[model samples]
Target: MYSYDVKVLPKNTSLWGGVGIEKAISSNSLLICRNDELGVSLKLFTKNQDDGAVPFGTLAPGETYIFRLNEVTLIGAKTTDDVSDSMVRCTIVCPQSN
Candidate 1:
């Protein structure tokens, strides 16, 4: 009943690609899956493509981070910024399947 998340359909979102319906999820905490912080998979893109990169090992309060969709695939990453009702959303701009 709080927040929500959804599987980005078609797997890619470009200017002319496609889009997935924004689902609601209650959990917003991000996951860092490596030793180096910047080498993370989950990412939040702001203006100028600034990385809302998730920190490794720990989830900081008021900070943004992300969870990888898998080992190789970084697209359709799970975002933690969508945790609260007031926090901003982190959407992944994937390539088109076709």
Candidate 2:
């Protein structure tokens, strides 16, 4: 298990201004949630942060989402407001290998 406080900054002209998490192990699932006390909406990207495609999903403050981690190579996060930075909390859990 691992926990991360991902910082998401405002998007700029050249970059999306976010953080990415690459798969490190054969994880069975992922638990992602926005900080309940503060911050704005968060947009999630399945591909690289620089990808031109739209975000796969969005999570509002105090919201939580769960899914398989193996299907994603990278997970990117960015603030939707584009004015302030957001701190998103992510928790990853992997089953022990046999």
Identify the candidate with maximal lDDT.
Answer: 2
Residue 32, model 1: lDDT of 33
- lDDT by residue (1-98, candidate 1, tens digit) is 12233332221211111133232222333333221222222332211122322233332234455453222112233334444212223443333356
Model 2: lDDT of residue 21: 38
| Ten contiguous residues with the weakest lDDT in model 2 | 12-21
- Determine the C-alpha RMSD for candidate 1 after optimal superposition of all C-alphas: 15.6
lDDT of 2 by residue, 33-54 (tens): 5554587777776544334434
**TM-score per candidate:** 0.20, 0.66
